[model samples]
Target: MSEPAVTQHPYYHPQPGTAWEHVDTAGSLLAGPTPLVTLANWQEEPHHVWSFQHMRELMPSQVIDGTDEPRPLPEAPSDLSALEVPVAWAPTVEELLDRTQTDAFLVLHRGAIIDERYVGRMGRRRRHLVMSVTKSIVACVAASLAGDRLLDPDAPVEAYVPELARCGYAGARVRTVLDMRSGVTFRETYLDPDSEVRVMERSMGWAPRNHGDPLGMYPYILTTTAGRPHDGVFDYRSIETDALGWIVERAAGRRMSELISERVWKPIGAFHDAEITADPLGVAIHDGGLSATLRDLGRFGLMLHDHGDVAGRQVLPHWWISDAAAPPVDVREAFAASVNEPVLPGGWYRNQFWFVPGDNGPILLCLGIHGQMVFVEWSTGLVGVKLSTWPLPQDGDKLVATINAFRAIGRTLAREGG
Candidate 1:
């Protein structure tokens, strides 16, 4: 099928504004020509990246899923000097630390906290935007409903969201949407004025500079026209996650934010409350817009590494974990081919999480735009969280190298402890 047509817009450049109110060193640290960050076929936008630590107030979100009781955290390691992994590609972490702007980093192994670090105005108390990592969290909520028979992956999506009957989602099955195989006619160009993604931004109030008529995201999503036949091929569409979120709301009879808090956050004993940004209409941006402290994100990764068991109680169904970690049936190879970009090779997308199929055992990762990650290697019992506000977007190579180095370091630690 042909790709959607691109739209042209007047190129924009960032103008110095009132310095970010939250960051103390905003003027001294963030001052400069905001670099243009481009992704895939997307055009570059003149953007001044904001530090993760100061993103909480910029976007608003509701707490959807969490547990009431705080899950007990394993003791933190006293020293992390023994863990070392040489970087095979890109600069080493130490070198990157010197050159790359970073916010927070945390590592866990065997359910124990091993290493934690913060940099450049980042602290344990601050919340950072997780961007697309929100997709994985939303996927978990959908999986929970499916586990309870509230949702059927094989069924048509219109069963839950009939409003999408006319858009690109028409005739698509829930599984296809979950796998991102929908035949939706949408463009993801970030800088294009006419792209549907840009339209989504305008609708969601993210494109503040655009004076065009308001095009709310949910309404635009419902209007997406079907392009290719359903299940014809795998296409990475963020709108699919949004659609899933809508379905989740329909089946659970609650908002995505609240559902996440009840089912995953509170039960797993999240260290802090996480928030998801909503549209002008108060609909949560499930594909992105999630924010939380680094420790809380690390704890969630630990829960996945433990096979959905927290404190010896099954918070999420074990089968749900297994299913979520497994690769998609039709799109594994296509997804894997993009791993060299920085994250993984031969990786699979399942339930919105990235799965690496290898002899080393499957590694499940939650990824976000602008370099947010929660990597969980089940075989080695390692979990790593990285949050960053890189000057530009679309640097998968750096992310991949960092994760590989992390895996290497994790192995060394396991051997020493063994």
Candidate 2:
């Protein structure tokens, strides 16, 4: 097999004289008087430098409000600029930011902020796209419901969303959907504009669409059909999360925006409100499309690190968080034999969260396209978040390096008493 990406050359940037050289990320101006951000493709190139953080401006969305009395994170910001993280073949932490196109990143140890920084016009107040990290956040809410017997993991999807009675998800259990073993025809290809991902994006108003197209999240979801049998094998399906989101809403008799605000953001003490992109029909895109400030994202990670507790309150159920952190045994084996196998050696997906098994306790992760990550290392009580706008949608090398960087940071924190 070819060398693992984490063990490859460190610098993955384009050549010195390429057109992307010295591109302006502030106004997203590519050339003189020519802004790259257009309705046709605001998510493309230099445009995303702005769009990634200002998604609420480009699309219809609903606010997931935060609390007025936002609980404060203890700050002891250490200058990690010189902290030499020992990734297999990665650059220094400071250099990695530039090499990876990170917009903002934070490192927390034991619920206190140790290091945080911003680049490319990103700051503490602005909410940046956490992309599919939204899936994990929504998953936590779903698990909360399950903890309270409001939803049953073994219950069929049809039990929660009876409208799906005729769909592929009809007989699929909520547990199967959570584990991504619900065999579906959906394929997420970000490079192909004609792909299903783009179809969903257009339906959600991320890209331009025909004036009278079938324009709703539900319509797009109902169109999907199963391709193969689900035999306890893991498949990374983005639409599965959307289906689970529907189930959660039906079970709670509330919209995702309301439930997430009441259960997650408000109780967790997020500093600012988060937003989710919604279809023109006002249905929130629960699979992806969450945007929040970096620090707030870190706060969620810290909570997960503590197994869903903050201060003395059980913001999320400890048992539920523990269950998510440790998936079914068969599912874990299936995950190791699947796509995410390469991402994390022995990783499993449960309720949209990633559980990476190791000698240390599981590393709970929330990963997103274009390099958004919330890594909660329970073994060391460390948490980290990195939000980026990579030029390409998928880069295996960058992802491997990111995992390594987090590991290095975790090791340093554990050893030096962060």
Candidate 3:
């Protein structure tokens, strides 16, 4: 049976006397006074509000099918909107959501839904574009394959996909790619038109292709060159995840969509069949092309919070989660040397997940451009997912505020023992 139609939830109501307000997405969609969302403008504001939820209509996608009987999200709803979060910009959590262009937000504490809200056209069933959150999810699949002995992180990437030997990934190990430590020169500057990220997006069919651009992600991968030796300082490159995705597929003798469906989505009991945008050649855009519902993402976060345990079944490898949360000392040293250190003080990157030191414990983060995040508080057993359509790809203020909000919420729940 089809899911029920989505209606504007009461939780999205603007808090009277505050600047908070819902994003008006009712009219002027693809056709109207507003500019139409095309391959070129879909990532832009105004258009992204609608395009984020309707990506399948704009591009070719592969369905990561879910189970018919979804896992239940036990509801114990609370009014967290009024909760005071320590942030310089927003006075309350509700205002933070609005200020960040949040489409959907959900919080899970000990496997129970504590708060859930939708804004504009977003609802329980809508699958919003998750951008680079896809990287963390793809890493989960890679970890699972490793646990099954189907893939080896120590193995060179070219062992699985020999074609990569001629590219920048010539001598990079699968583990190197997972931690974004590959020596490949990939400028991830989102705003720069001539950045390597934009160029790769064009090859992947995400942007309008220009003359002389590579045909697809594969050809583009070959064009990249090694900037330095492998196993160097941490570099925030999206293409590393793409190479990691290819390695897992080759090791498992399957496609990324199938690997994700069998290894992560279904195992988590996702309610909706998630969609992944594909290139013109039908290659999955593993770096940042996933679209999934809010609740499903919360479920994925919960699994990580519970140390990869779903009830009695162990879905993700326990070792993988532990290593990611608390990596070796070198990982921290490497992260501290990177450009991200100033933004994330005393943090590290491992296995595609971002880790920030918290007062209680290490916090695990799966972040995407434009305010997409899955926040997991390890010690507090709090998991939260925020899906947003921020006008700009990166906003330091918004990102810090969101992280603080989740941290505050986790602390509150831990104190209450609820």
- Candidate maximizing TM-score: 3
Ranking by TM-score: 3, 2, 1
Clashing pairs in 2: none
How would you order the candidates by lDDT, starting with the best? 3, 2, 1
Candidate 2 lDDT (Cα, whole model)?
0.79
TM-scores for all candidates: the values are 0.83, 0.89, 0.92
Tens digit of lDDT per residue, candidate 2, span 1-418? Answer: 5421211112222235644333334334334434544445456666678888878777788999998888788887777775576554556788777789999999998888999999968999999998889998898888778768899988888888878867666668888888788767777877665667677666666665644445887777777777777546788878888888999999999999999998888878998999998888888889888899998999888888877888888877888877777655887888877876876787788778887764487888898988889988877777999999987777878877777778777787788884
Candidate 1 whole-model C-alpha lDDT, 0 to 1: 0.69
Please give the TM-score that candidate 3 achieves against the real structure.
0.92
C-alpha lDDT of all candidate models, in order: 0.69, 0.79, 0.88
- Estimate, for each residue in 188-258, the C-alpha lDDT of model 3 and write its tens digit: 98877778988899899987676688999988989999989988799999999988988888999999999
Q: Which ten residues in a row have the lowest lDDT in candidate 1?
A: 36-45
Model 1 per-residue lDDT tens digits across residues 229-315: 877655567888988888889988998788898777787788677877788788888888788888889888987888778788776
User: What TM-score quantifies how close candidate 1 is to the native fold?
Assistant: 0.83
